[model samples]
Target chain A: MNTILRYIFLNLFVRLIVNIILGVNVRNRDRLPEVGPAIIIANHNSHLDAMVLITILKQKAMKIVRPVAAMDYFLKNPLLSWFSQKIIRIIPLRRDVKFVKEDMFSDCYDSLKKNEILIFFPEGSRGEPEKISVFKSGISRISEKFPNVPIIPVFMHGLGKALPKGEAILVPFFCDVFVGNSFQWTGDRGSFMDMLGTRMAALEQEGSYL
Target chain B: MPFNIIVCLMGLFVMLSIASTVVFVLKKIKPQKDYKELSHRVKSWWIMIIIFSLAMILSKKVSILFFGFLSFLALKEYLSMIPTRRADHRVLFWAYLSILIQYYWVYSGWYGMFLIFIPLYVFLLLPLRMVLIGQTQGFLNAAGTLHWGLMTTVYSISHVSFFLVMPKIGGLVAGNGGWVLYLVFLTQFNDVAQYITGKTFGKHKIIPKVSPNKTYEGFFGGVIVTCVLAYLIAPILTPLSPIHSIIAGLIISTAGFIGDVVISALKRDLGLKDSGAMLPGHGGILDRIDSLTYTAPLFFHFVRYLYY
Candidate 1:
């Protein structure tokens, strides 16, 4: 039932609103594995990023993918928690550095074991929506734990300007999600995250959608 | 005042029948690569002609709204291909808003506001709104393209639909549908004539830098043929005399040719082969009506100045 609601809300309802508002486009979407336990790493630009991510996913990929959101942000209010639990189907991770480390490891590992495709903003949280911040160490930990899962680097453009940070109303803008090459972890956290960040940035530059 | 819609449709049906037969014989005779494309084009033409005639015959309001929606679609297709910075998005809404305003002028029969609103008034407004957005990067590029996009698609194309509201144009036909029919027929016929002649007899490139397909032989041939068609059909469809219709036909074909080439240039500059891929054989709404963008405003002004 939750999966059906998630599909309806994310795939159908949110996709509709996003298309009507942003006119989203996706390129090289077939690059992602059709049926696999994978981690989606995209540039975090707006509140619209996750929904836009869902909009860009081909139906099968959309069903398995769940955005890994901060527990503090999503699971705080009861209504938001219900929405996050039921419709968005978010894999909530604690953001607090001390308490989050152990809990984050287990929640993510369990989700990956269950074959849920997890979405991560390796930058950890939204920054100055236009700029790609240095990725945090969390993605490295997750990918290191699950060496088989492909870390798919996705780059989305124009959503920062469409919704951005702290903006309640969406301005109509053309947004595109460019799917890039995914690679497996080789135990180096620093260079891997750096390379992943470079790959995501390369996707943006390669798009030439300026 | 009432031109014969039934006769016009019958004429179109006869033309299609002849075209189908010729294509059938040609396909059987020589298995050329162009035959498949030619067959696809002819099939698309049949559908386009029927739907266009139906919309025009429906009602005046329906006809106006139909073209208005078309202009909106053309603009959407044009802008979708052109790259704009993030900051210019807010300004895009206002640019789209001009379509409604431009069409409302057609609806209300307000000529004065219709003439200058998009080109002059909205021209100033779009940039001002962009300036307020505070992004300096690509400011000029964004504003200029949006303004031109609206002007080319909405303001100019509105002239075709504007025929419905012209003071004395209703007296030229039962409804304004015939005037629209006449304009569209000549414009489209010019396109077909150019393509068919260009494919068959074209040797020298007219302006290869812009449009590789346009040939000098095709240009002169299409102009001469479209003019003859206009001269022959004008008395049956529009208010112009044979001599006047010949001149109008010459102007439309020439202007139509220029419009098609200019849009080709736009596509080339943007590194796009076609404006879009919406229509199967036709390309995009912009590709379909690039000539109408020039022909509509030019023909509207010519008729309005002398008659209305």
Candidate 2:
């Protein structure tokens, strides 16, 4: 009953506060995993992108999908910190460092291994909408670590317009979420990043108009 | 007390009877190809109406919060639909804060502060925010977009709450705040009546490019019917004379149509079908409240100027 209440409240709260205020639209969500351990790789444009993606995934998967957010930024403010951790269940990654400790990557690998979905922005950081930034090798590393896990590429267009990087007010606009087919990582580590980048680039091109 | 309870039960029965009859009639009509989708949409409406009724009856604060949350969603959707750059993020934060403050001002019944909350503070803060962010490129366009979101979402919808906060006019039926429910009921009724009338008698597309479903026949027919209904229901709902009620109905209905068209244009520009799929048939929070965005502000100002 508590779970039901939480779900209802979360739905109501998000509907009232986020979805209404931001006018986020989750499209082409049928391609998402209804239930399973998978990697949700989406284009990063704005802070709203993370919320929009996670909200839609929760709605689609009907389960909590932990988003891998940059710990430095999201955990800075107390209010945002609480919301990101409690409400969205964001898994914070220490990104400023040159090399992430082995323990952190192992924890992420464990989550994926345990059938939990992990959301990651392969670009490592947000960027301009006009171009998809060069993807960090972290995602490829994760994929290599868990070859059996499914990597779902999601392209989010217009999030930059919704709440751009430095801007606070959202311009009324429509955003699209295109969830592509899940694929496995079988290639060597050297070519894995190249292949992943190519796939992400393709999704970006396809969903650019959205 | 027994008599009052009996009368309330009788009224409940009558309302249910009327609703069922309408549903029966609608069911008898031939189902369109989109009937499944339409039925799903109607079911969602029933769920929402039930929720609204419960909230209104349960607590005033709950109802206000509910509506405030809705306005928040509508505003969010409006802003999301437009384009912005990285430089405009700070302004966006202020925009969200403005939504919260506007609603808070309304609930507090401080009409004086609510008046200039947006145009004064927000208008100034947005540019200053962008300047602080130090990105001058596309500054004007970004500020304008942020301002538009605040105007439509926060400033406009707060008018409804403002009505609730208005000093009650005398000479009306005692104990039920004057015309707060009246304007809200009539405006929403206008929306319902327009949709029904348009679907039934609509022909000769009106602004096919912007809103393909709207028609001139629907627009006029909805307004006339709503005005007549408003005239009849005024005595029960408000202190307005039949003539004034008729005028109010006409204003709300016509303005509501314009509201739909304006939001429709926004959606078209963004190449979107609905604002969001939060509501199954209703599209999104924005799609459902698009009409309210215009009607609430216009009706609030109209009532304030005329009555208050």
Best by DockQ: 2
Task: Give lDDT: candidate 1, residue A77.
Answer: 99
Model 2, stretches more than 4 Å misplaced?
A: A1-37, A44-120, A126-131, A136-148, A156-177, A185-210, B1-32, B174-178
Q: What share of the true interface contacts does candidate 1 keep?
A: 0.21
DockQ of 2: 0.32
The DockQ of each candidate is 0.22, 0.32
Task: Give residue B50's lDDT in candidate 1 (0 to 100).
Answer: 81
Lowest-lDDT window of 10 residues in candidate 1 chain A? A16-25
Q: Fnat of each prediction?
A: 0.21, 0.46
Query: Over the stretch B184-228, how does candidate 1's per-residue lDDT look in tens digits?
Result: 889988998998899889999999999988999999889999999
- Model 2, span B53-143: residue lDDT tens: 5544555577677777767677666665566675565567667777778878888888778999898888887788789889988888888
